[model samples]
Target: MAEARRPRAIDLYSGIGGWSLGLRLAGIEVVASYERWGPANETNFKNNHHQAQTVDIRRLSFADLPDGIDIVVGSPPCTQFSFSNRGGNGDLEDGLEDIVTFLGIVDHLKPKVWAMENVPRVAPIITKELESGGRLHAFSHLDVQTHILNLEEFGLPQRRRRCVAGNFDMERLRAYASRLERLTLGDVVVALGQDPVCDPLYGLRIPKAQLVDHDPEPALNPEELRINRANKTAHTVYNAMPFPDRMERAVRTITATCTRVSRESIVIAPPETPDCVRRLTIRERASLQGFPITFQFYGATYAQKLRMVGNAVPPAFTYLMGHVFQGTDAEALPPLASHAEHLTAPAPPAVLTPPDRPGSVFPPTRSFRFAIQSLQLKSGVRFELRNRFADGQTEWSVDFYFGTSKNIIALQMDHALRTRLVMAIPARLRREVETALAGVSTYVEAADIENMQRVWTHKGVGGTRPFMLLDELDQAGKGLVEVLQSEPEVSRAVVDAAITARFGDDRPAVGLAKLGRNAPVIAAGLLIGSAANGALRTHHLRTTGRSPKTKSH
Candidate 1:
């Protein structure tokens, strides 16, 4: 009797072989994988021994794949649709291009089944009818089902919520789900004082050197400390994370980008030095995502390796999917039970628990409420942001009030974005603003003037309280130097002085007379009237020999 040939499959966008390894474990042969990033493809090949092709998926057609690919699985990049990106406000047209390509191949190949996964936000976009065949909208004709699954339920040790759409049998997979028990952070990743029940293989993969604690985060950087603290609130005071992580339930989502600055990176206080906090090592992060110890990731930099690990589908969960696709029974493996040492360990110091959250989201001593309620530019454009600021720092829709339009939002912008917007202004004007800024000790931005008509959105970082952008739903002249509530440091005089110098006394100057203490130290914009705007444009056209772009205003 001859050995039975295993059903062949292909993994697209296979990052570190999460899908490939899982499917293979389910008795399917992952014959080939297609990825565009060299590091990821190289890692896939090294680990899984598949023919990893660094080909652009857009150019792939029927001829490129093997004749009989029983399964086609891929995760199109989720940057555009993810809520973490621009608060779910990314350009849909640009984001859907890759998805269109992925679906096109599935349509072309007409495989027995296919699967695609992405952040939960992508669920509505893919399922609802979109455009015609040239694009991927309205693919209900393909007959695939979409399931929004939480990895915690399937026994993974992190809170990973994903929308998986596939033709694989749900009933078979559902059966596998029933037999599995939920696992928590303590079961996998190492934490302070934990006697972990993590797989022994994980111990083998982590070097003894890697087990050493990271140096403590600087204690005095108040702003970084504030951000980390706010993230426990998760953009709201309503839902909070255990400060130094309780290790009781699954930890928060493990993002592709991990930093100590945001709560997404698991923070722990070493038992030996309880006050000092450090992030989980790379090996721990890998373990959190359900990658076994022996799995190797090849990359030039630590960042690249982390990206591969973070972006992967949890192989533990996928193994079940492989069984569903292969029409086979999954061996019932009981979830790891909690170890007594892990359950009884002492808590990390300082951050994890407080009946009430620490510090203030908005300055309690804000001067704006007592000062002026609103500020009007000399040109009659009225601006107001105090009410928003008074609402809370915990809730920032408009950190900088530009005007009254939805496109022009009022939100607290991080330093990087603030710098980028500042850099867009012409040098001469920039210099002028900077010179005046010395008096107010604030910033001058083209966002209120040049970017007035430009649509702006904020991306929410996972595990952090977002300075979520608030839509300015006022009249047409959206965004004004409204009496926006500001940091305690920004005084009424500061706003008045900036407005005075930025627009000069005679130009469309912002009048801060209405604001006092609470007035938002808005990085006030130059309120260039139509005539002045035209003059600046004309000057630029003559100076540079370029046709003027009519301002969208």
Candidate 2:
């Protein structure tokens, strides 16, 4: 009998080799990696991956890629599409460039399997691009799937809601994630046996804040203290972020940065000194992110190290994903803990205590259609573009609600409930919250709120079960708020594209933009022009030997 061959793979935007590490653990050989900003520090991709290349993907040759590659995985930068940076209003062009660039690599490699991780907001954009004869028509022939998934549901011990899209098995992903015991912030603490103060990684090599033997919370300057003071408004609907982030449940998502004032910051006071607390140490942050204790990040500075850790996809996550890609049964593999006894989750951020509101009608929930998703993803039942165009419904209007988690939940109200919902708010918390919003004033009107698909949390189907969670509703929302937040800019970009196409027509330029927000017909038409297949298309063809499909094709 012959021996089975190990699958070969490559990673794009391979920050510190998160995808590579995970894949290698799953019996896949990560033969090559591409990252733009490879810090000169020793603990980077060059040390970990078999062939880490700092050369930009745009500059690489098809000959540069490893041969016989079977799997491809990458977490393209999410900053441009994330809500935290600018309320999901970052540079769409730059963000789209990275996405298209990633697709370009996939096109050239034409690997057997691939997947991408990004904020939930990016799902629609990619889905729209992959539609029949869409902008990224290259891989439309393959069975690609996109879904907004919570990583915690996959047993990674983090309450990270991300969009996982690719040709990977949806059933296997679901089954593998749940196979391991669901862990919590406390479980992570258990995994990281020693405190940062005692760890070898934390000694004189890291930041002073991380090395402090003083009481946990670092001494804050006066301004930060003023901003962080505890508060209680009769109108306060949110459950307070616990002093030390909770350890029982999965932690909140960590990003490339952290701060004292941000709600997402993980503040923790050691059990012995629970009175005062401090933000997570670099090593602690890495553990929470699912890196083993032995994983040495060779960055020169703590802040730099923090960025590397925060930006990585947990190797544990990729392990399960790799199993599906390689046709391996994840259940037969060892648990995530077996990788390194030092493994720990970014201990969860909050001690959840979901609260109630006065509506008697329904409670809020950040579970689905968060401020951005709710604005964009709206519907349990869907309607086609033609159907929507023919409906003759008036322009959409803005509205608000609190989620069960107390995070602001933006809802696109119906016409009939416009006045009622607005009038009802003064009695609840919206009066104050409305002002907190960046001065939004549009109103949805005349649609029957009672008949909308999102049955209020208080009720379930035929009252048979509590509608505590709406999985499908995750696909809905993003009506007026999304437009209001992204437009003017999006409109301006479209307008700019139109101008370039018209004025530069003689100079070999055409207007094409990928706003990801449902572009206007005229704008969409412009997008379907020559530019979609121009530079990106040429790059794909030059790198790979195949001519990719464009909208014109």
Candidate 3:
């Protein structure tokens, strides 16, 4: 009798082969994979002998794949569907493009069965009626069943809930879910701590259980640390924090941005020293995602490693589904008792919502409150940040306020973002700002503006936050002085003198006075208007090349 061949399958968007690893372990041969990211594709090649194609799915053609593949499995990018996105809804265009391409691949292959996985919110989008024949014919009628499976139910540690769509039998998969034992983050931590055995076949560097993906975060003061310990929760920073994951249970979904320290990043303190909390290592994160101990991730930096791990589907969960898909018998396996019940739960409302500390330039009054509360100011606006000397090595950092409609906002500026904001200004203004900033020795990184924007939404408000540009000469820095000198009758000294004398004061005045010209009374009427009722009311405007408009009385 001739030996039977293993069933063939193709994996798309195969980040680190998480989905394919499971199927391969379940007796399926994943011959090829389609991945656009270079580091992730390298990981796939290392784990499985997948001839991964480094082509964008949108541009991939049917001729690019192998013949007679039985199944097509992929988990398209789900960032756009994630809840972490600001305002809870991400841009649909990016997610839709990947989803369409994945479907197109399936349509091109016309595999016996195809499975697509994404965030639960994406279920409707995937199940919506999509035309076939041109790209993916399997989605022509959109008859595929959508299964909302929590990875925890399949015995993988994570509590991630993903929407899986496929033509395969769901009951068969559900039957096998009970056959696996419950896993947790503790198990993953323990497994990763074990020393790697030397493999004679492939001599890869066996990294120890040391911490990775750690960034240089500002250390908390002793008092702050004490407070955090007493509270036993993630500390608040920059008004936003990530929801910390409980170690006893499966972690929340790992995100690609976890490489950078965030409030939501999982923090663990060793049993001996519970005071020191640190982000999880890349290897540990991979283990939490159910990659085997022997599995190795190759990347030049922690960022690449984190991105691969965060985006990968847990292999253990995938393996169970793959086993069921391959018609494996659901023989009852011994159930392991879960120990998570004994672990004490953390305090509710994960983010610590403490009131913002008082700002130097702006007070904590209702007027200032409305400034920060308004959602109208878009991200990436530049503000002139000033650090004025206070007491003994302490300086008060203040954001320059800009008026918008009825609200006022102080622009936040970080070193890296400030450089980009200055550079991005109009060519003539940029030259003047740069000339005035010549003596300042801070580093300039025009390229890092986007990265800074990802973390902190506000910074140097160049033209973006233009509430009182050139209004008061004292408020204008040397850079602003140079830029404003272009206006008629405006000079550096003239601006200084006007600011000093407080002439043409726009703010509300407390008292009124009468004045005459040439020592002769031109008009006997007293100046009745207060500064609040001055004609020069603050004007608020966006940088969309439109004139500023003052609110009506």
Greater lDDT among 1 and 2 belongs to: 1
Please give, for residues 1-553, the per-residue lDDT of candidate 3 as tens digits: 9988888898988878988877876778998988888878877876676688787877877776899898889988888877777745798767788877777677677787788888888776655534443333455654567888888887777788899988877887788776766666666655445455221111222445322332223334342333233223312112322233455677766676742234445656544345655556665666677765456566666566667778888877777667656776677321212211211212221122222222223222211001111111222111222112212111112233333424433323223334433433456554654543432221111112112211222332332111121111112243343344353222322222222233235531321111111001100000001111121111111112232232111
TM-score of each: 0.58, 0.56, 0.55
Q: Which stretches of candidate 2 lie over 4 Å from their true place?
A: 40-42, 46-49, 190-226, 229-240, 341-553
Count of residue pairs whose backbone atoms collide, per candidate: 32, 33, 12
Candidate 3, backbone clash total: 12
Models, CA RMSD each: 15.1, 20.9, 17.7
What's model 3's lDDT at 143?
A: 52
- Highest TM-score model number: 1
Give me the overall lDDT of model 2.
0.52
> Model 2 Cα displacement at 490 (Å)?
47
Q: Quote the positional error of residue 304 for candidate 2 in Å.
A: 0.7
Q: Candidate 2's residue-wise lDDT over 1-553, tens digit each?
A: 9988989888888888778878877778888788887662224453454777787766677787777878888888889988888766899767877777777777777888899888898999887877776666666765667889887776666788888888888887777765666767666554344444222211112222432212223533333332243211011233345545676677778777765645566765555455655566555666567655556665655557668888888776787888888776666856654544332222222122121111234333311121222322222111111001112221111223222332332222222222332333323343432342212211111122222222334444322111211111212222223333434444444434444433356422211222234343222222211221232234334444555332211
On lDDT, who's better, 2 or 3? 2
- Candidates 1 and 3: which is better by TM-score? 1
Order the candidate numbers by lDDT, best to worst.
Answer: 1, 2, 3
